[model samples]
Target: MIDRYVRPEMSRIWTEEATFARWVAIESLVARVQAEHGIIPAEAAETIAATPGPDISDVREAERTRDHEVLSFLAAWTKAMPDESARWVHHGLTSYDLVDTGLGLAMRDAVDLVLDAARELYRVLARRALEHWDTICVGRTHGIHAEPIRFGHKLATLAFAVDRSLTRLSAVRESVAVGTISGAVGTYATTTPAVEAEVLAGLGLTAEPAPTQVVCRDRHAELVAALAVLGASVEQLALEMRLLQRTEVAEVEEPRTSAYQGSSAMPHKRNPTTSERLCGLARLLRANVGAALEDVALWHERDLAHSSVERVVLPDSCNLAYYQVTAATELVDGLVVNTDRMAENLGATRGRIFSAQAYLQMTRNGVEREHAYRTVQQASLRSLQQGTQFADELGKDGIAFDESALDPKVFLQDEDVVRTRLHERLREHGTVTRP
Candidate 1:
């Protein structure tokens, strides 16, 4: 994780202390489950459950000599307990019995935090879309003016994209929220499936149907892939904000404070730093996908190939995802929309963006397609080159037509239908705080 971009809540999830603490939790639960089956004495289970987690520093020091984290963690934990309980600790369990279960729980919680941040962003987008449902602006394609569209319509497109992203994350959460205690080779030669089930249930995880030395890597890869998609969506919106805040466009700006500085040498620069940062971080999140996909294929049942790759990519990807969407929420929810600038830019090409409207209207009124194209193209070109109004050029040709069709809002005539559909969607997702 980038230290400056590290979000506090997400940062804590991947910490060594947190990881060690989860291991202790799993060990205690395993003991209790084993005790219920009479494999360990009930009093020993009680003592193990009651003991505080071992110091992370002690675990690290022990790991230096043992060269095994779970073993070192167990040594540090068991040394603090009486012989009777220490003997029962990790009895009939392998390292992954503690490690993978603990990891699943940590990933589940981290993804939950990401989901919460995404939901907040969804609500903000919905509310903003409703607020500006009829706010008209020029729509662009390939960085060129294409036609007129409501600014809110533009925002609603991303709102729906995020809705899909939310659905993907939700599904990936369940996929990765599995624990395996099937023992080293997954034959359950020593520990029974019943023990695995009960321990996983206590930890709020379900048993992986089958596992090798570790739970299947496909589940973990699915999670990273979803986060990468969400990161791309974040970049989509951030890039739009960056484009709109350009000096020539000046249609919107990310939230700015008085002390903000964009250029050190220039005084009049209010750059889209937040949006740019969001875009840049999203790239890093996407780059992790190849590493995650590579981790899906371990040698034979399992190997160390995937392990080292996951150690860096998984946590870092989650951290980057949470940071991007959370920061994007701040950028979006507080945007400074310059309506006057939007209107000015809409007309910057002298009504040429409405060429489609004229073309369609002509075609509908029984004009030849080629004739309509020629007439409208000529008028649009005349308006652009000679600085004359489109209607004036049309008037020179003596064509009687309703002037109302040329108005910007003519492009948003079906806004009511759009609002009704969006309202239903927002309500379905519980994001409808306002009508």
Candidate 2:
């Protein structure tokens, strides 16, 4: 099942051989349904089911020459079926009958694989988040220190995002799991609507209430958008890891082996390459979402425009998302968070991070708000410039009455507020909730 360019599971879903195999299954199922309705000879339907699908090599060559996959598949399929049954194989069914139905099978299979990977990702994320529940790191806004937050809090939040994405993916699987055997214009001019219903039931899918020469593109578009959203969530986690691994803020890093070489010129580099790769591939999924959106607006009830685009977008989006999810789960499982470095870096600014808390306590103590703000700001800037502790600097200044009045420890006493919030927020790791 391996795609020539991706993991075996994903690649198999989009393989030329697999594509035709699903097509054959659809056509055979239709023949059997037709027989049950007395539209065709029951013996002929049984004969067709008894034969296997086309050989990959023959099907490929046929596709190359014919320039249409269904035509190629039909040619190979008829050749394999008992000669008498061949005439009834695709009777009264249009190309979309095979194409869209086969695609549903492909989509259903691919989604199961994606869900399996996402479930693993959830487990890894949850385990890691719990492991680092008490490991404090500096929280930042606009890339500057804001306050202390547990690494587990951020990891847990990412887990929740991924969980929501899984839910969306499940919904998409339901929406896109429709099949169609409606004729050229979906009015069933050439066949009974009962035939479409029976075929879909055999394929374990629901029949679209109505369809044209093609199944409505909105279903396919929704599937791709779900993929894109999942990719974006994975990218969010990767970007965070990349930022954490920056030279100035090396609080976390991806796992590296002794034999791993990051760069030829910089032997010291152990980059977050897996996370970066996920980030880059995520853009591809996003771009594919745009293409899926475009596919939704075809000319009239049907158009060839959606056909060519889906040929590329559908397979590639599923494959890419599968790869990203696998990569992200591994990255989360192997991530190394430097608790000591996080603590060290938090102290790098010499206690100025707690100045806001200090300012709040002064105000609560009945000091003028404006005066408290000015006092804390002056101390913070002085500490920032002179490389001195803000608390010590404030004590040395006549501004603060005495060392006893401004215990940096007292100002910092509110650290537990952040800790408590994190614990509550991460109570159920890998599960999203209303904030």
Candidate 3:
């Protein structure tokens, strides 16, 4: 991951130092497993385990000469260990065995960090949804007021989306939490399946059912796709913040710190900078998904095409996602919701926003469906043109109907019930876990 998107914990998991550390751990575990199976001397396994890990600088310097990361790492490792035990460092394993397994550990840790951020965001959204559950607002369709709806209802929908994204991320984590010790061509020519199982189990991973010199790229693709979807969810929330914070529809505003400055030239600007940043980063995440998909098709057993792409896409996507979730969480947590403005805006369209309720009430009062629809449509249009309420227009136009039944409050009468049900569902999904 680049420095710009890096969050300390997530960035640490993708560092060169971290990568080498994981490779060393995997090597140590493999040696112990081999020793247990009588494939290597116990003394050699003990010596290898006792050796200090290689410095990242030494590994990089070795790579400059070897032009192979695995060989370079192994060369550095041999230099650190006793001469006799050095030969047993990577005895029967192929490069992909260590590389892919180490990659799995790194990805698992990164995903865990992202999941923590997502859970926190989910809780923030759920709490805000409950807080605004009964606050009425105009529901818009085609950018025009359509009817009355609780603002909390809009937020509840977003909360449910966050929950679903978390579920998908958990599934993706399981898919990526696999390791393979199968040798060249996945034949296990020298290493045994038992050794692979034992080593992976010790690392909190499952053995890949099958591999082709590398773990299947489909797993990697799924991981990136999941992160892309998560990014899209965050972007959806940020986009809503941008829209609601618009000058004409100032129903919400992102937090502005004491030191915050929205613009250099404008004096009154309070731009949605954080929300816009999240939206832009989401586009990059989606683009990475395409690259991950392309990585799925490698020539025969494997190729280097997927390797270089994974180096960029995996860490970058994870880091971007983690940052987006945290940024969105802060935006939501400190959001300034203008409930008074929401109420005022709901009336901006006059009473035409309640036309559907009036139409339905007319039908229930024995008016034919078509007749009621036309009546309400005419009254609604007149209300707009004459700057009158829909109910008053209906009375003036001689459209006989029960005025009390067409009350706008009737549209939101069941709001409490709906909110209770939504809250119950969110509770059932459980509380967010902090990392």
Candidate 4:
């Protein structure tokens, strides 16, 4: 499916109506399991399972009178359910046994949407990397030109980073897809482990090996951690886009259109707004990590602290991650890569970027390492200050360098392994090696 489907599907997954349906479904599944285990009457389980969940309006209205969220949910649910079945809706469960388990179902659906967006991003980036494989550009370190690297090499790095993040996301999605029907304090006093297992099985989930009154927060923490890392990787790529789009650099421009308007007063402005937006939203995902990690250490046997926090972070992080990834894919797919400008900028410093190649050549030619370094350093500095070419300065300094050392193609000589990796990970697709 196209990326347009991602947002609406994800939003639908977390809606209040969707949440109530999942909560009620989980309770019904639990009731069926309890009946199968001879804990409740089979007739009541059948009625509960047959009844539809409460309406969203009813749940919200109930919440106005009931301070407890799950209690309000139960009130709305029981009111809709027949009295015989309503009495057993939450027979032996604590609040989170319903809330957290229902959350697992919702999160699983949301994760699939995120994975779809991420997969689309990976496809775009991989194709772009191959398309620009031999496109050379100057590489920089500490904001100064250092050497030559292919534009594709830069994109290749990002593709692999995204691929790695996708792997982590897949793993964490499984970890977060666990359901816990364990009773208060997880003693299984009121319900049996058998009931939890059968209920989870019915819902296509796995059992949380151990659960407190709530599913352990570590699983949720891992999910958010993966999202945070993915966001950071996207931010790194976006920062590169912003830098490359600078007037002085002008090596790349994020996608823009006739409809785009930058700076309200500066009519001539065409800023890298998409990149800036990506960078800004990434911080929100990172900010959620601290809260997720904090949620892991709740008071003994669990507490309500994580409840309030997750209500905000879980939906926000998932939605933000999917949005950022999809937006990045659009930015990159439509990005205007100024190859001529890339070549022009490489020459802006008058062959300074080739200094490393020159130095390596001298060393291989038997010049002492320290002496070769100073000779190239002095020549580079003189060329910069005098507004002269580095080659001329080196010639004047009696340095004998082969002309090939100045060629940017030297950077690709050792790139066979990287090309192979890109082909394997990006070209063929889904053949990635997972740990």
lDDT of each: 0.88, 0.82, 0.87, 0.86
Off by over 4 Å in 4: 1-6, 431-435
Pull out the clashing pairs in model 4: none
| Candidate 4, residue 402: how far the Cα is off, in Å | 1.8
Error of 2 at 297 (Å): 1.4
- Order of the predicted models by lDDT, top scorer first: 1, 3, 4, 2
State model 4's lDDT.
Answer: 0.86
Tens digits of per-residue lDDT, candidate 4, 1-435, equal 134323676777777888888888998888888888889999999999888888877778998998788898889878867788789889989988888888999888878888888888887887787788889999999999988888988998998898889899899889999988889989899888988888898888898887878888888989888999999999999999999999999999888887989989998888998899899889999999999999999999987889889887888888888889999999999989999999998888898888888899899999999999999999999999999999999999898777787888886798867867887775456644321
Model 3, runs deviating above 4 Å: 400-408, 432-435
Would you list the clashing residue pairs of candidate 3? none
* Residue 257 accuracy (lDDT) in model 4: 83
lDDT tens readout by residue for model 2, 1-435: 134336787888798888877887887788888999999999999988888888877867888989886788788778977678898888898888788888888998888899889877976786687678667777788989877777877887888788888899889888888888888877788788888887788788988776777778898999999999999999999999999999899999898777899889998878888888899889989999889989988787777888889989999999999999998998899898898899888787887777777777678878899998998899899999999987876676554533443333443445555435434544544444223
* Better candidate number, 1 or 3, judged by TM-score: 1
Sorted on TM-score, best first, the list reads 1, 3, 4, 2
Q: Write the per-residue lDDT of candidate 1 for residues 127-171, one digit (tens) a residue.
A: 788888878899999999998888888888888788899999999
Candidate 3 vs candidate 4: the lDDT winner is 3
> Which structure among the candidates has the greatest lDDT?
1
